[model samples]
Target: MTEPNGTTPSSDDDQIRKILETLLADDEDITARAVARLHPSIKAASSITRSESRSRLLAEYQQRQADYRRWRRRVAKRSGADTATSLADKDVRIAELEATVQLLTASHLAMLRAIGELGGFSKWAKFYEHHREARDRLAGFGAIPTAPVSSMPAEQGGKKIKR
Candidate 1:
């Protein structure tokens, strides 16, 4: 099969490949419009180069990415075994911190249940919600709001504190 212009597909592909190599050597962008501008004889330059040049660009980009990963691995090795040890230590520290947070959450829930049994949960919830809202409002003013007196223990509870 041949184009109306009498050029065969394989021949057109060969031409496109050669043009792409020239573009690469010149360090210029390998685009259909650029190819057409350089060699107008190749009719429908985009369709001709779509299969040829796209794979070439994709391979180049993949090579660059692989080079970057290899460079990072080399740098990490140069930093020595201490960096690996510190990374392992950080993982352990993170696990310990997560466990501590779980324990604190359980304790907090137990305390809330005890307060609910004493029928003081409603009042506590109201005060807690109001405190959060006040804190958020004060934050916009760049001020740190103090805890309300109602949030204190029964022994320390007193009249409501104004902001």
Candidate 2:
């Protein structure tokens, strides 16, 4: 149907074409309106580009943080392994020292027993004096002393007794 302007709805395309032709005939006003219409679209495109750039920067920062965390974990693991190895080495050394102490203790005990069996410190002193005397006598006369009577032993009560 034709409106009061006498242009039918079916003639919308023709009417728009005519308006565009008239605007083009006078370039200034239509250019201003076209610029106005495009302003928002240009701003929207720039905003989308800025959002994409921000997302890319955030992704890069996250990747760097992940790399740093991985590096820290690796260092911690290495330090832990080193600590374990050091503790193991210390245990081995302590065991070796303990074995050495055991050996020394056994040797010391054997020496004490031997000293006790040889008539103790006072008896050993007396024996040494007699030994020196016998050596002096032999050097002077070219003759050794006979064995002492008390040194002779006999079995008695499941033990030996010196005469």
Considering summed lDDT, which 10 consecutive residues are worst modelled in model 1?
144-153
Best by TM-score: 1
Off by over 4 Å in 1: 1-78, 131-163
Candidate 2 per-residue lDDT over residues 1-163, each given as its tens digit:
6645555533533433344445444442433233223332222223222445433433444465566666667667777878678779999999999788667656754554555555463564466576897546533542322323222345699798865
**Each prediction's TM-score versus the true structure:** 0.35, 0.29
The clash number for model 2 is: 0
| Candidate 2 local distance difference test against the native | 0.49
Backbone clashes under 3 angstroms, per model: 0, 0
Candidate 2 residue pairs in backbone clash: none
Name the lDDT value of residue 153 in candidate 1.
30
* lDDT against the true structure, each candidate: 0.61, 0.49
Error of 2 at 4 (Å): 99
